[model samples]
Target: MMLPLLEMTYKELADAFTEQYKKGPALAKALYGEFFKNLNPKAWQAEEIQASPGLADRLREDLSFSPGKIVDEIHQDGLTKFVTELADGVRIESVILPLKTHQTVCISSQVGCRMGCRFCETGKLGLARNLTVEEIIGQVYTARRRYGRSIRNVVFMGMGEPFDNFENVIQAVRVMSDQRGLNIAQRHITLSTAGRIDGIEKLAALNIPNLNLTVSLNAPNDDLRGRLMPIHNTVSMVRLQQALRAYPLKKGNWLSIVYVLIPDVNNGPEHARQLADWLQPLRAKVNLIPFNPGKNAPFRAPHETEIDSFRRQLIARQIQVQKRAPRGRDLMAACGQLGSGIRQQGLN
Candidate 1:
């Protein structure tokens, strides 16, 4: 149990205030005061650093992503670890994916999820609530203390429907990209949505480079997309493709098309061809993921032969295709696997 006297980090302070005490603006201010008090006074005294405007902006703004957080165990194992909890019966999981090069924190944007997809564990719980900006960003600070370094990348693909929690999600993204704190480049960040039509437009307006905006495109046709993801029932593939084309994207920036290959479901070479045909016009890349099985998730991954066949088919058509290495599986860290501990402990 945390003592009332513990020197809480910015995130800890916010969680205590919003989730526990129910105060909003006042708690946000107090958290800011605490942050100002802890900032290192001797950070920017170097002569070369003072000469560059870009460097100054980085120091003052983009670096302030996760305030008042630290890694407790992220650095020791050189791998990610998560802490699961529930406030008012809503499941929340925080992840820190670590590597030799840099650490990345995967944070959730909502409790459970309203965008119920067939393959996601979080969505199965249904939507409880959209997390506040502070609640979303707090996970970063908590991971930092456990791990020991500022994370190099942030992927908003953890446990919730990031776009469904649009306003708060963007606010958290803004704070994370702020220069006054964590100076992470927006390019190094990624956001995945099941498929939210309006959210894609908003992201396009942000115009942040190398922001890997990904869509979970699991099917070749509307019928299949609707079957895999319930959101497609409303925002069909045809409409999603239209929204994606409207986005002002960089030349080389491809809208990452995430295809979860499940046995006999969406794992055939013909399905691959159909998908490629559907996406040939869009500036996009296909990331073939062998479905990560979760609790009560009926889907199973395709055979390696089937996966290779699909990848080759996409590549033959000159579509940029790559297979993403699944991470944190040992610790149940893949997408939709983060909340098992909470369930086991009866927290949610």
Candidate 2:
């Protein structure tokens, strides 16, 4: 059984090196640096590797660098969607969005999803399995390498509900934010959940610094929310709102509440007013996503006028809100548009 080098945090790698090779933290730091620099054992040229005889060879022999391979990639409208096939042949999709200044990578936390949100393509597949820490981090590394862009932001908003795969997702975040590794700042990482109260409470208890939390809150009340998101049946909107209010947010940082505007469903002005009232207790900004219809989508996207009206209603209520323009819809890379191909292929 080989240990995954990418799965270990800097401290864990350093401790392992100190315990097994009698090398201090300096050597471990150098090795860790080299591993992330090229993500290839053969590309290592750190001075520490040359100074310590057989150290590089020993690392290659002991540790495994298996981030899987990018099997498919698609580019459309400034968005790139890439699929990585794991060693076990399970495939997951990740997207790279071109931001104004820097790029952002959206990574998956699980293979498919169990939280059957009515608008999500991934939810239709049901739950396959949670991604490992290596698998989750591997998407970022592979995307960065292939796209050749500096990824300044990372969002757990690709395939599955992040909070459902809590441990692996958190471990991946720790490794990604470590200065010696991916070096992405904690503030740059965002974890989006489908309103899982247990996961919400667990994350609040962790109190991770500067980490952004987004809740997929499509509806304002329990009746409508339950129809849109099956998770609402287990965790009511009131309870979810209570958890969000209790979450420790840094100064000037507010939670993101994502509302998918499905036409004739939850896109009415009354719904917007109710949403504003629901959000009154928490520090949250609403991101209005005009529904991107997936294959056999139960509902159509709201018209531009309807979207504008909904935004106006929220604004009139003094709720901070922003309408997210649909991106990568042609490539099926937009919100609620991932996992259909995999599901159709019977991969899940």
lDDT of each: 0.67, 0.87
TM-score of each: 0.76, 0.97
Q: What is every candidate's alpha-carbon RMSD to the true fold? A: 9.1, 1.4
Please write out the lDDT profile of model 1 over residues 63-156, one tens digit for every residue: 2332222222222233565653434445577677766688888878777777778887676667767776756766664555455555768888
Per-residue accuracy of model 2 over 1-348 as CA lDDT, tens digit each: 354767888999888988888889998888888777665544235778768988767766777766788888899999999888898899999999998889999999999999888899999988889999999998988877777648879999999999888999999999999888888999999999988889989998998959999999999899999988988998787788889889999999999999999889998778987999999988899999999987778888788999999999999989999899998888999998888778888773
Q: Where is the poorest 10-residue window by lDDT in model 2?
A: 37-46
Highest lDDT among the candidates is held by which one? 2
Instruction: Name the runs in model 1 displaced over 4 angstroms.
Output: 1-78, 84-89
The runs of at least 3 residues in candidate 2 whose Cα sits more than 4 Å from the true structure, single-residue gaps closed, are 41-45
Cand. 2 Cα-lDDT: 0.87
RMSD of 1: 9.1
